[model samples]
Target: MREAYLASGLTLSDLSVQVPLAKSKLSELLRGIGLYPRWEIVSRLAALLRLPHVPLYRLWRQAAFEAHKSREWVERSTDNTTALTTSPAAPPLDHRAFCELVEADYLLYAQTFLIDDTACHNAVGDTFDILWLTWNEALASPDTRSYAWTMLRRTIMSRTPHIDGRPHFTHAAFDTAALTHLTDEQARADHLTETIALFQVMGWLPPTQLDVTVLRILWRMPTERVSELMGVPPALVRSSQHHAEHFLKSALYPTDNEGRTP
Candidate 1:
């Protein structure tokens, strides 16, 4: 509880007010969940401690596997084919590609980390129409470009606990700071290329199979809509997003397991 409070910039009293459980009960709950008071609790802790309705999904997964002796049931149920007809059976991604994708995603996310709510909204609104047009056209084609387009769209549009309201770029400020040195056309092209490369690496698609045109379509998409298209559930999306962020952070700023920068 203490660590969670510290990491979230909230006090124990502040959390008590937000959460339904009494302070004592909450403390007990935290202890039962294997968290020491000194360990830094992240967004996961905040969600678990404050929101009565928000399930402790990670904990549940852990316990479920421990109890069941195998994750086969969960895996079977959550298999890609069970969810979306469009979900492809691509090979696992290579480490290099995964690292590159993680890096690009981190860069994109870094652009919006400091934006205020109003700015976020305005950016999303402005970017959505253009992205939608490009996405629709890309979807119409049935090649590797189409697959990349689908994957990118699904990744960005899927619902996540971190983002609320409509999944539109207007809601999130589009970060142009990274492109300040480039011409408008160059910036757009670069954005498309970087984002496409990121997705290709993450999705584990081969360079020969990657479609630059599809990436062009994704570049214009609103972040929220992209999340929706990804078909990831809202809560899971947030968790996955967190993992992706962590992966990027680790890559960009290499550190020991103790969290000290190398």
Candidate 2:
């Protein structure tokens, strides 16, 4: 989409005014950054680009299917796209029920890390869409919840921007800053400095420790649920959280050159 927009010689501002979607969302669409867009938005953009509607809709359908959107919902979103594709297999009721049950958990997990509502929602929706595609396999597994949780993590992690091969947490700086109720300028600055340091240290932790820290400390999910989602024993979850806290303390409060606490 970015390539198409570039080739068409239309500025982002032009596309923003022309398309029905918001400018920020349009930018995300063009960059392929956020949730897979609904067909109507894409179709209008394609029309503006003089791209063939049928071919674009086919591509969009495949993406939407992968993102876990229902065929019925996709069809309802745009008649033109619906006409271009054959009817898809309906998602099972069991899968639907599973999605309803875990969607909030998935959203909370994503938001606690991603920090952007759109990206968080997209990750959750994509997780379910992927689980729907693999429902039979998930059912065959001894623990369906575990299998689905793995799928959800994969979906979210892939979308999570990384720094030096670790999950990036610097994006959370804005939200972290917003949490402070400090009124003094110096105090607020002090709080933000520590918050950013903590977020950066979080990105440096080993993956398992990072996951445990986020679930147990930041999101405040119960240890049992964290254990299930991570496919780890509850004891291990507690241990990891303990180690993560230790690491954070060391990283954020280093000893001085003479071995004295700073």
Candidate 3:
């Protein structure tokens, strides 16, 4: 309701006048849903938002159904409604959780891609030149490169669904396998070196601080874990994360640069 009202450029007061319910009661209804305006208030708020009420209502109903289904899946082990509804190959992810994961993946990928691309574009030398040097120095033999590629392929494959109709949720398994395979000191050193080089090329880190802290935090930690690691309050972490995300997008797809908004 608030999102619709804001998008329509109308205040709650403006909406209250058009609705049948008293403003105070409308406010209470909205407050019940983490919004301040009641449904009666937003009854005409749809028009202000330039959206028909019927479609919006339908969308809201669908969202509510999905939320209810997700909760049901979490609470009742016997119920496999969601699993049965989705394709067998698709992981039995709770709808809300899967959406959140997908959103985070998109944001992280965009940030990393932008930072890397920009660094490569500004370099006086060939961008992959550093990657090649790092590979040569870190890898003991030609076989090492093949091994690394295999490790990478396995990790990617584990997260992805098989070509066959097998139903598997491979993320946890994939991480375990990757960590186990790359636990050797030499492999760890090589990975760290390559990661640092890539970050340097992306201007995400300086030579003095080769750890790529932000990327590590984003990749290795959950949002709540990131807050704990940063040692700030959760709210502050959220604010900082949002600002950092905006900065990354701006860096990658500048306003003056023609193309998508990112």
Candidate 4:
């Protein structure tokens, strides 16, 4: 809302003329320090700004209901009957809880992409950027956790989807399998070196293969979860990951006719 106001380049005085509010009151409203406007006022303002009404109506309901009533609840069952009960109010989540959720998500997220500490931190930071810039207002609603999760997921998805070794992507896109098999015990001992090489090799893989490997090995996410996130079937996720592993093993550790690493 603030963003739209800013983009319109409308000052408080300018907004006052469009709606029945004073500059001071408008300032307070913008800062979240005043009473919510009546539905009529909300409707007028929404029209002036050309914003959608459904969600704005929801905001009005939350404020109006909370002020006049106690906890509000809705009930449902698998039988499709509407149940009624006074459910507890949603607890407000502070910044601490938000950070904790992000951290927990990252424990799974950090596993999906092979990123340095700085890059990973930047990715997490990016989520907060979205939170404050876009979704912060929505946090006041009952589904704060879901809002936070969605913003973070969007941030992660926005990042470079593939390992970008780019100019540094050595022509080593060729067969290095004979040089080091991913399955070799000796190669396993040099994980750091192998990991670096693997990252480069991954840069060459198609998006599907790379994404599957990331969700499975790096994120350690279950097939169903990966399927949900990627919008693919579980079988496809497994198949892609399997083929990716085969290519990686064959590419990383090729063998001579003797069936030994040359």
The lDDT for every candidate, in the order shown, is 0.38, 0.75, 0.39, 0.57
Q: Write the per-residue lDDT of candidate 2 for residues 24-114, one digit (tens) a residue.
A: 8888888899987878788678777755454355557767777899989788878654332232445668988878877877787787577
By lDDT, the best candidate is: 2
Which residues of candidate 1, in runs, are more than 4 Å off? 1-177, 181-224
Residue 179, candidate 1: how far off, in angstroms? 3.2
For model 3, residues 98-213, the per-residue Cα lDDT tens digits are: 23433343334233333343322322122122222223322554443233333322322333333243312222222232345686898866655544433333333221121123
Q: Summarize candidate 1's per-residue lDDT along 168-242 as a digit string, tens digits.
A: 232222334344456689777767565434433333322212222122122444444434433334454355555
- Any idea how many clashes model 4 has? 9
Span of ten consecutive residues with least summed lDDT in model 2 = 81-90
Each prediction's number of clashing residue pairs: 21, 1, 2, 9
Give one digit per residue, the lDDT tens place, for model 4 in 1-262: 5565766667888778867788898778667677755565555555656454544544455446546633332111112322222322222246546665456555455434423566557656655544543444656655655566566555555554533543122233222344445677666556646666786776566767876776686557789876755556789988999999988887777774348866
Candidate 4 to truth, TM: 0.40
Q: After superposition, how far is residue 93 of candidate 2 from its true place, in Å?
A: 2.8
lDDT of 3 at 27: 62
Instruction: Report how far residue 141 has shifted in candidate 3, in Å.
Output: 50
Model 2 gets an lDDT of 0.75
Compared to the true structure, candidate 1 yields what TM-score? 0.22
RMSD of 1: 21.3
Give the TM-score comparing model 3 with the true structure, all chains together: 0.25
By summed lDDT, the worst window of 10 consecutive residues in model 3 runs over 80-89
Relative to the true structure, candidate 2 reaches a TM of 0.63
Q: Estimate each model's TM-score.
A: 0.22, 0.63, 0.25, 0.40
